[model samples]
Target: MKTPNMITKSLLLSAALATSAVLCANAQIKLNSKTVGAATKAVKAVTLSNEDVIEYTKEYIQWMDEHNPVAPADDEFAIRLKNLTANLQNYDGLNLNYKVYLVKDVNAFACADGSVRVCAGLMQAMSDNEVLGVIGHEIGHVKNTDSRDAFKSALMTSALKDGVSSQGGTAAALSDSQLGELGEQVANMSFSRKQESIADDYGYKFLKDNNINPWYMSMAFQRLLDLSGGASEGGFTKKLMSSHPDTQKRVDEMAKKATKDGFEKPTS
Candidate 1:
């Protein structure tokens, strides 16, 4: 027979061992998720996440497909977009896709379902490095699942906001304003300071991990900052800021990080 204190100690020990085992298992799962991330439980769970948020994201995508629509597949720029995406190397198993449009708006963006669209203007704005940076940023959106999370938040926001209210009751009732908004926002949304920072981090990690120069992202930010004129008010200069963080801030952050990371020789 065991004394009461011994029994209590034994129970405590067993509980601690069990807790450690569980922690170890969870850590392993997290590490595995980080490595192949494309098909991990969380990855697969993206579709199965039964929360209101995930549901809204899926519903919104379906709504947009049938509604606002995209440029046709036969556009000549579409052909170039295809060429660029096809040659995309160093990124794998991310499940993102790409498209191009002839829109004269001068923009680019990525959606949750692996859909990325580049404007003809954006295509002309970049060389190999800047293009990779923009593409990497888009890929960051996919990797972080920001698209889904944002769509969910935007859906809830739209339902409560004037944007949806003024569209008429029927539009709100049958169609997904959240989804429609997601479609437009994904292409044209500007991230908050925090979101922009996270994307910058992701962009750096992606380029660094892939052995590409992390400075390229900083370089692209500089170009956007210079061309966009960075929030001095008015015209095409503010276009990027309308849907993203101030290019100036992003460039500064990237430059600082790159220097710290030993940007000994930037790409020419």
Candidate 2:
């Protein structure tokens, strides 16, 4: 009675109807509380105010200090950092605080909340002027609002999705696990080439303001390049140079700036 094509069309319609009915029946699947909370926090991260950023950054820095081995006042690393940063306590309206992390990693970072952590390994690898050069660069990120931007990006990740509070009055207290994840994200964060260049200019000016030669900027990068065996492909070297402009280019630029500014490159 029906043609073969009509029969086939009828069978296909029946299958489509069955699939739609199944989907409709399962459309009311429930989400657990954790899923709901994470979604809410993700939304909060997107809407975080400047005050919220500082509060959360404070909490993150506290967590970092608790987890890392901060050098005591009597420690050589602590004394050295204290001396080097004595004049930087109130830099550019920032009430900065400095601490040395007794870690083997040659790294340093500055937080938006005026927190700066320098690793002992970096100090060991660099002279006082070179270390100041590095610290100046870190501070430049804070002064340029680069740290705040980087922190916001870190908070946007799924790992830190549950890290912020959903409340409006204050930043939500993060758990140890959330704080740890946030720390990891911040540590691995990288800046754009433009941001890096701006920070470099800030560092150069910072040194000149402190009456120190800007040659150390080039020296610091040269030391890092040597430590990387001139390879930026992988390992700690990659992390140090992560998403940055070319290392040699940075070295050359700093050298040129120093020369133009009437600072001689130190030869030893």
Best by lDDT: 2
Give the runs in model 1 whose Cα sits over 4 Å from its true position. 1-76, 87-93, 160-189, 232-247, 264-268
Q: What Cα-based lDDT does every candidate model obtain? A: 0.46, 0.66
How much is the lDDT of residue 155 in candidate 1? 37
TM-score of each: 0.59, 0.82
Please estimate how well model 1 matches the true structure, expressed as its whole-model Cα lDDT.
0.46
Residues 122-235 of candidate 2 have per-residue lDDT tens digits of 899999988888777777778777787677666677476665654646666666555445555554556667767877788888888899889998898789899888866432
For residues 86-201, write the lDDT of model 1, one tens digit per residue. Answer: 65533656554555444343445555555555556666676666666766665666556665565434433333233222111122222332233333333323445565467668
Taking every candidate in turn, the Cα RMSD to the unseen true structure, in Å, is 19.6, 17.4
Question: Model 1 clash tally?
Answer: 5
